[model samples]
Target chain A: MQEIPKPTIRRLAVYYRCLERLEQKNVEKVSSKELSKMLKIKDSQVRKDLSYFGTFGRRGVGYNVKELKEKIKEILGLNKQWSVIILGAGNIGKAIARYKQIEKDNFKVVAVFDVDKRKIGTQITPELTVRSLDELDEFVKKNKPEIAVLAVPADAANPLAERLEKLGIKGIICFAPVTLTCSIPVEYVDITVFFKTLVHFISRGIQ
Target chain B: MQEIPKPTIRRLAVYYRCLERLEQKNVEKVSSKELSKMLKIKDSQVRKDLSYFGTFGRRGVGYNVKELKEKIKEILGLNKQWSVIILGAGNIGKAIARYKQIEKDNFKVVAVFDVDKRKIGTQITPELTVRSLDELDEFVKKNKPEIAVLAVPADAANPLAERLEKLGIKGIICFAPVTLTCSIPVEYVDITVFFKTLVHFISRGIQ
Candidate 1:
């Protein structure tokens, strides 16, 4: 397989969501131009990115919405269920655990852990309880979650990520504001970056 | 003076943060190579991105960390204070309101509003309280927040954004998992996209 650029990977996920939205609206087919207009992406760029995976759309008929959605789902590994563990019981962690869409999207929140003893044993969701970080070693050995969601503090994120990588975690979805130096894939969900982008545009009088 | 690419804008923010960390550690100077190594960006890419703003640094002496950080901060509009209103009082909204870093970053949570009657009048922080969405019109009229944060449900995001645009909101930082169609700039904080990225990498055995 050809190496896909990271931005293209992100755009593929976006295309999947856009198609999902189209399906919900009872739309059956979409042209690259239509998709690009909806997403503000270039039509040629959309075609080029999708071609990295495989051709789907016909010459004039465009692509079948459901078919393309499912194909991108498989390409993104969203077709299979993924077991996930949340590493904080803070607002972000609890919110993610309580997010119904996660289960719907084939990602399961198998467990939640926190360093706060006061939060330990507390129920985040009826199906999930916050566990002590001290129990992480035993728990990981037993349940073996594939992904770890880091919602911890900036200072703690790096060391925790190192441990999670050592424990064989495949990837991390980090909500912390720090840079992680783990060998495993770390997706930093730095909300402030979005804020910075907003300020930059606002200051530039773009709006 | 030039039209900076959106990706470069985001990178400027990243460079500012990385430099801030260095300043905290009393690091006085850094080369493009050192910054790129810390950020996982290409050295030439760093120099090119920074050059879009202005030329800095002397030959073989590296860039003064404090001077470069301040310059990027000014370029990104982080030097000026911004008034912000969050439109949802749910977990994400509350977390963002309660975040102490916002004030540090020069963005103030001037107000928070929600559609839920039960949540209104609740204190999210010692300084901020949740107001009814019904009061959004008056609040925007009276206070004139430059930015509106959309943390509401996906379905509610678009219409609310339309209302905000009409109310003279400069820009938006949206946390809802939906495509917002507004005349103003919208910065989307789609956490699920990050999840999709992680799953893609994990499934591809990239780590």
Candidate 2:
């Protein structure tokens, strides 16, 4: 398979959500033009992105909304349940644990970890408990969660990320403001970057 | 100025951050190759992104780390302070309001708004309070925030976004899972999309 562009992956997810919404609205079919109009991107861009997985939509008739949605869901690995452990019990980590969308998308938070002894025994959700960072080795040995969320402070992130890699974690979702030097695939949930992007547009006087 | 690719904007922010880290290490100069190696991107890509601003660095000596960092900060509009209002008092909203990095980046949360009566009149930080959504008009008139954060649920996002645009909000940072259809510039903080991106890599066996 050819290497896909990173931006295309992001857009594919957006297209999946667009298709999901169209499906919700009982819209049976959607053209690339229609999807493009809704998303404010070029129609050709839409066709090109979907073409990545294989040409699905008919040239004239367009794509079947539910089929396209399901295909993208499977492509994104959302069809399978993913076990996740968060590395912090701070405000952001707790919010993520409580975020209803993660479970709906099949990424379940199986555990929350923190270095703070005061927060170690607390409950994030009824089913999930905050555990000590020291206990991570024991938990990973048994449960083997594939993803680790780095919601710790910047100073703590790199060391914990190193520990997670040693524990056989495959991927990471980082919320730290600082960048991690980990070798594994790390996705950032940097809200400040979004703010900077927004302000970049604002300063440029673009709507 | 030429139209910049959205990905370029995002990468510029990343480069800005990388430069900040280099500057902290007291590294006085950096080559595009060195930066690309650190960020795991092509050297030409880094040069192309920096070229969007202007010709900044010498041919052989590379870029002065401090100067390059400062220039990117100015280009990203991070040098100026931005007043912001968040439109939800939920866990995500509270997390964002309490996010120390936003204030560090000069984006100040002037107020938080919510429809929940129980959350209204509450303090998020001692300097900021959660106000009723009904009071948005009066507050906007009195203290015009340049940016509004849509941290509300999917169902409530669009209407509140429309209202924010009407009140002259320049840009938005959205946390809702749904795609917002507002006219103004909206940057998404979609954590699920990041998760999906990570899983796509994991499924593809990318490191």
Best by TM-score: 1
Off by over 4 Å in 1: none
How much is the lDDT of residue A181 in candidate 1?
Answer: 84
**Per-residue lDDT value at B177 in model 2:** 75
> What is the docking quality class of candidate 2?
medium
| Candidate 2: residue pairs that collide | none
Superposed on all Cα atoms, the candidates' RMSDs to the truth, in angstroms, are: 1.5, 1.8
Q: Over the stretch B1-207, how does candidate 1's per-residue lDDT look in tens digits?
A: 987878898888888888988999999989998888888888999999988867786768889999999988988889878999999998888888877767788899999999898999999999988999998999999999999999899889999999999999999998888777787988887778888988999988884
Tens-digit per-residue lDDT, B1-207, candidate 2: 787777888888888877887888899999888888877888999899989878777888899999988988988889989999989999899999999888978988899999999999998888878899999999998898999989988888888888888999899999987777888889988788999999888887776
Residues A1-207, model 2: lDDT tens digits: 577777888888888877877888899999999999888889889999888888779978999999988988887778889999999999999999999888888898999999899999998889988999889999998999999999988778888899889999989999987677788988988777888888888898775
Candidate 1 local lDDT, A1-207, one digit each (tens):
876777888898889889999999999999998988888888999999889868888989999999999988988889788999999998889888987767877899999999998999999888999999999988998988999999998889999999998888999998888778888887888778788988898888874
